[model samples]
Target: MSSSRILLASRCATEDEISELVFKLQALLPERRRQHLRRVSRDEVLEEVCSYIRKLHKQVDDTSERISQLLASADLDADVLRSLLQQ
Candidate 1:
C-alpha cells in the first residue's frame, strides 16, 4: 500500500490504539485486493519507518529516565530507613 494510505489507516484504526497501519490494511482486504493496492516508493517507506523508530526510541529514553528517578528515590528511602534503625 502507499505510504499515505498506510498512515491514514493508522489514524483511522479504531480497534486498537497501538495497531500498525500495515496490519490494519492487511486485515481490511483479501490477498487479491491487496495485490492491486498502490505501492509506495522504498524511500517513502524507509522515511516512515525511520520516523517511527525515532519516536519509539524517544519513548524508551523517557521511560528509562523515569525509572532512574524512581530508583534514586528508593535508594534515598533505604538510606533514611537505615539511619532510623541505627538510631
Candidate 2:
C-alpha cells in the first residue's frame, strides 16, 4: 500500500505526455490488480505527477503575469479609480 520505497529510473516527459501515458498505462491494468499495480507502478506515477506539477506551476505563473498585464492595460490603478469616481 505504501509507495514511498519505490524507485524508478529517471525519465523525461512533458506534462500532457505524462498524463496521456499514465491514462493509457492504468487503463491496461486488470481490475483486480489495480491497487497492486499502482504500487508496482509507483515509478511511472511519480514521474508523471512531478511533470504535471511543474507544468501546473508554470501555468500558474503565466496566468499571474497575464492578469497583471490585463490590469495594467485596463488602467485599474487605485488612484485612477479615485479620480474617475470624483468626476
Candidate 3:
C-alpha cells in the first residue's frame, strides 16, 4: 500500500479508538449526564467530566476538614488517635 493509504488507515484506527474511549467515559457518567450527552459534542462530554472531578475534589476536601476538626476537638492521646485512625 502507498504511504498515503497507510496514513489514512492509521488515522481512521486512531479515531475509532478515541471514539470507543469517549463512549466508555460517557457510560461512566451519571444517567442524567449521559442522557444530556446523547446529542452533545466531545468537548461537552469533557467539560462534564471536568465538572464532576471538581465536585469530587470539593467533597474530599470538605470531608477532610470535618475530620480534622473532629480530631482536634476530641483531644485524645497519641495512642488512642493512632488506633482510631487505623480503624
Q: What is the lDDT of residue 7 in candidate 1?
A: 86
Clashes of each: 0, 0, 0
Q: Give lDDT per model, in order.
A: 0.61, 0.63, 0.86
Compared with the true structure, the alpha-carbon lDDT of candidate 2 equals: 0.63
Better of 1 and 2 by lDDT: 2
RMSD of each: 15.1, 12.8, 4.0
TM-score of 3: 0.72
Cα-based TM-score, every candidate: 0.42, 0.42, 0.72
Q: Which predicted model would earn the best lDDT?
A: 3
Per residue, candidate 1 scores C-alpha lDDT tens digits across 1-87 of 889878887787543543455545444554654454437543444455566567779999999898677666775677776775489
Off by over 4 Å in 3: 1-13, 77-87
Better of 1 and 3 by lDDT: 3
Candidate 1 lDDT:
0.61
Q: For model 2, how does the per-residue alpha-carbon lDDT over 1-87 read when each residue is reduced to its tens digit?
A: 234323221345655676677767665555654455564454765565566567779999999898677767785779976775589
The TM-score between candidate 2 and the true structure equals: 0.42
* Residue lDDT tens for model 3, 9-32: 876766678778778888888999
Q: By how many angstroms RMSD does model 1 differ from the true structure? A: 15.1
2 or 3, greater by TM-score: 3
